[model samples]
Target: MINRNNWRLVKDYIKYRAEIDQVSAKTLRLEETWLEHTLNWLGEKSIDQAPRIRPVFSDFVLSESENKYSSEYLRKLVSAHRRFMEWVSINKEGYRHKITPAWLKTIKLPRQPEEEREHEFVSYDEIIQIARTPIKSLRDQRIQAAAVLWFLSGIRIGAFVTLPIKAVNLDLLEIYQFPSLGVKTKLGKSATTDLLLIPELIELVKRWDQLVRSKLPDTSYWFAPLSPETGTFDRSIKAVGENRTSRAYKDLKELLDRSGLPFHSPHKFRHGYAVFGIKNFTTLAQLKALSQNLMHSNISITDGIYGMLSNGDKKKLLSSFSPATSSAPTDLNQKLDEILSLLKQNTPIKSE
Candidate 1:
């Protein structure tokens, strides 16, 4: 019979090890969730019985992979068990041999196919269409601004949820994604990114900025919740407690439904921004600039993630590069930059 004490020990070890690794609560919760399934699969067997259950571990991983879990997700599940086994071996010496490298190696993780890894891109034109096909109230404007900002800045949805109005400097045409300033960037990554060099996008964002500032504190979220009675942003909302990603999704869906455009998630905006920017880039500096603007660690990482181009895009782009034709118009690029600069000057020091 399984010893209850041993089962509890393994559970406690997961929490302890997760904390030492400094993983976020979301990640820790995932680890715990996957491990619970592992325990259930090993029903009636104590963790100390790990040596006898080694084959079961291998079988379980294979079975789970065969059920069609994505390779990345399967890898996480395998990693969760590996970490737990490593912890059990160190903390509970009797199971050391069962959890050794050789035994753990028997567990197979699924490989993610290339096609399954790609995200659907939401085009800049489509975002503008969604923004233009407006609905009633300040809430509708907030949703439109959220969609525009995603394409304009390529900020992750998590960071966008907690972004403070002060971090978006319309005057400078820059967004400061700093954790110190209460922007929940990935791993607390901080960067100052210039807004997309599109005059219409800048104007759209400026209207949103002015609308929010008129009702809420600078410290409040750029996408702050609206007050039902006042039909303006609720100044009393807390800065960081709530995660509004789902609410953002619902708002976007409402807009898309009204506009007769198929619904696309907020994350698709990041993919769209990367694809649009990379496809139009004429210089290495411009390429790297896009990478930095998206908050990617380096150019290679950006390329690796967003490098895949559709065959249609490839054929059209190659045909445009004729021997008789000169390089992309430098004047057009300069004009774009100049328009962005003109809009930046309108950003008042205190955003009055």
Candidate 2:
């Protein structure tokens, strides 16, 4: 059994790396859970006992796989183990090269399922329903606003929760996701994105923005806290910080139920933005603009991650590339016209 002191040392090392990596608090918390599960399973087993522990580790991974853990999840567990052991091999005395003989060489991660990989993004109609759903309560109104904002701005729920009222400029149709301003952006990234171009989406955001400002200071969350007692925004409440993200999810599910629509998380809105935006973009410049608006580092990252087309859409698109028909099979003039038309617009003529 690995001693308690050794476990503490491992934990400290993980913490040290987390700080250096600037991992989000939520992700760090999950990594801690994964590490704890692993170390507990290897209880009291010194790093040098890797050879004897190989079978045990393998069994543990097999059990998790059988229990329906996702390929992504299993991969994360393996990554945790690899990172921990690498530290152990380097820092622990007499543990040199020990990780190489351990189960790392034997473990193979499972492939991710296709259904999970190519999930459909939410549709514009769905967001309209979510936004227009009739509800009498202020809390319900807030939920509707949340849904519309997700569709319009593609804001991640984490950052949404932390947004202060002033962070959004409804008149300018801009959102400032500044972490130093307490927006809780991933990797503390700071950027701005324009709101959705649809007038309805803009109006929905405008209404909520005005309502929140009326009730609280500019620094209060745009999605203000709901008073548990009255089930509405507490105008008198002075406390400032993010509301629980889980509660926002619950509200979304409740809204979906009321609208008789399928439940999709706020993050899926981002996917919707990518899929729908790319589909209609008439030029390469427009595509690149959308990618930048979504805060992707490069156009390829945007395409690789969110540019998935449904099977039906793919077929329809390919059919458009087929040769044009003419009145007679030997109509050379018509055939040349069709070919020339296709060739003219084959590339985007829009200025970069």
Candidate 3:
């Protein structure tokens, strides 16, 4: 029987599988959770011995894939285990067949469709109100500004949390989102975005940047986490090592409660950015260009996510058919206008 001591092998693999594989941060945590469940099931069986209970593993994998776990989650576990077995064989001889990669080929995943939730729009007034309110402390105000900038700029949270102060150019009213700095961008295409257009937000970001730079080197990260150590020096963006967005989300909810505003997370703001830009500033061609700035593949992706018509907008469309509606073209007016124009041309009418 596999005792707790033998289970250490599974735990060891779980710890390093993601880092060794160069997986995403979210992916690493998930694999660790799944491995914990699988090891519990194999309480007494050794790694090499466990898969002889191949039937048991198979049933558990399938059930987990179909039930508690989604298809995405199931696929990740299978991948993690396959890599774990490969690691075991190279480091600790004679466990090569434990993974039996063939079983992974037969595993089916629970595929979820693209998320269809509508993007929540934050109004200009709401932004101004939040800016005016007191945030209890300077740190809270910094978090609020970060949240606002995420919505205002359509920048990714991953890039947002790690942005260095040197990357910002407030004098030019621009932010070097990608190519200008070490900040990672999708496809690595970087462009500078104007920040001066939003004066209030510019003031907030300037204050935050000044506060951060006074404490850190110009090369230091803009968003650093709270340190538990007394008098420990703060680290660079990469050194902080944890996502600032999760805590930002929690703090934002509390801010909303005090402000009496409805809550919407940072991602929905991204969706709002796409839809809002389309609705206001431009035509379809212009919209495609804006969507490109947002790094979307096609205008259709922008339209699909942002252009679902609202009930109020639909009501306006339906109201346009009424006789009193000034927008409606009248048949009598069209005929009269045509006749008057013909008379002005001095055209003679022939009797049949």
lDDT of 2 by residue, 1-352 (tens): 5468658866776677777766766777787877775776677866567656655554677575685776667778878777777777776777675666444566445454543445678887788887778887888888888888888887888888888888999888899999877888877789998877889877877888888888788988888987899887777755544348888889989989999998888888888878888788755567767777788766667788888887777889988764655245566665556434534443322443
**Residues 169-283, model 1: lDDT tens digits:** 9898888899898787887788998778778887888998997888678888898887779987676778555447878999889888997888888888888888888888765
The per-model lDDT (C-alpha) reads 0.75, 0.75, 0.62
Off by over 4 Å in 1: 1-10, 48-68, 110-118, 228-230, 318-352
Task: Show the colliding residue pairs in model 2.
Answer: 1-44, 1-45, 2-44, 2-45
Local error of candidate 3 at 306, Å? 6.6
The regions of model 2 sitting more than 4 angstroms off are 1-6, 40-44, 56-59, 100-118, 235-243, 325-352
The candidate scoring highest on TM-score is: 2
Candidate 1 local distance difference test against the native: 0.75
**Of 2 and 3, the candidate ranking higher by TM-score:** 2
Worst 10 residues of 3 by lDDT: 343-352
Please provide, for model 3 over 1-352, each residue's C-alpha lDDT reduced to its tens digit, 9 standing for 90 to 100: 4478546776666566555656666666776676665675566776666556555654667665556765556666766655555666566666666555554345334355654443366655566667676877655776777766765667776677667788877778656777466676555667665442578877877787777778778667676555546323356235535656686778778877778889877666665555556556533345545555576655556567665555555577677666674534576576456545543443332221
